[model samples]
Target: MTGARITVDYDAKALDAALSQAVAALDNPIDLMDAIGAVIEEAIDRRFDTASDASGSAWAASLRARQGERGGKTLTDTGRLRASISRAVSGSDVAVGTNVEYAAIHHFGGEIERPARTQVLAFNDAGRFQSRKDSRARRDGVQPIAIATIGATTITMPARPFLEIDTVAEADIADVVQDFLRKSLNT
Candidate 1:
């Protein structure tokens, strides 16, 4: 013999058992994905209600609010953006978003540039630029005043991010996943 040879064989039955159970449990994760989606949606809705982001930081006030116009919550004027939010689950994947055209602008914040062909652009002025006298007039139920502006103007919109899951929401998701796994493994 050239040398003493040693041979050893290892059995992976235990590993296979554990893996097979997990694979079978997660074979179809549509329900799990839906549950996760719901958790995320709830967090987003809460953000809208609290006027805060996923990190629990308050969002910047809206232009209207800064202009001394009392109204409903920011980003909920008509509730279109919030109401348009929805979730779609496919297989093991889930997505949440809104189809509103202005959703991105509000979420990301950007500048809107309006160009005027003429030198001066005249339009009706409402609560935006009313003087104290004008305010008195308005308080007396007078009609809105007219105002003029020169050249192109850029309007900057601040970002009010609301499309994310917070730490609490993450904990909720973990609970959901654990519950799913526990139920799956039990069955």
Candidate 2:
């Protein structure tokens, strides 16, 4: 007498369904670089606000004052410089910058010169020197600043940084990412 044995196989449909669900879950990943860029942009805008001194920032007051000064169509004009600022994102990378030429100089203190212009500094009676340029030179025993070459007009700039991330702002980045993920998952 011989005995018969029976074997059973399970279907792979359940496994395939689980894998497909996992793949679907991975389809929409949360991206928060855009939110970071937005926060940075807002900070920059706030730094450039043109409100009054007591009610607003000193930078805002100074910038507003500069609007009426000599530097028209210049990067020092808060409105134009603020407008020139832009943020970029690529995958997980992000960057914030300005198109204005003197933005770097403004953010970081530096000296700029007009090489084509000349200035004269003459010694006064008490061994002191008075510096004047072109038509404004003092006519009393005037002495030239340079003997052979023309002096470049120099202006020393103070640093005024408009883009910065503070502790509060830094801590909010994680919240931003989490919120983004939550909304994305909900959708």
What's the count of clashing pairs in each model shown?
0, 0
Tens digits of per-residue lDDT for model 1, 34-84: 999999999889989999998878889887656655464788877888898
Angstrom error of the Cα, residue 42, model 2: value is 0.2
lDDT of 1: 0.80
TM-score, predicted candidate 1 vs. hidden true structure: 0.72
Candidate 2 lDDT score at position 36: 84
Q: What is candidate 2's TM-score against the reference?
A: 0.54
Q: Clashes in model 1: which pairs?
A: none
Ten residues in a row with the worst lDDT in model 1? 117-126
How much is 42 displaced in model 1, in angstroms? Answer: 0.4
TM-score against native, each model: 0.72, 0.54
Q: What is the lDDT of residue 177 in candidate 2?
A: 67
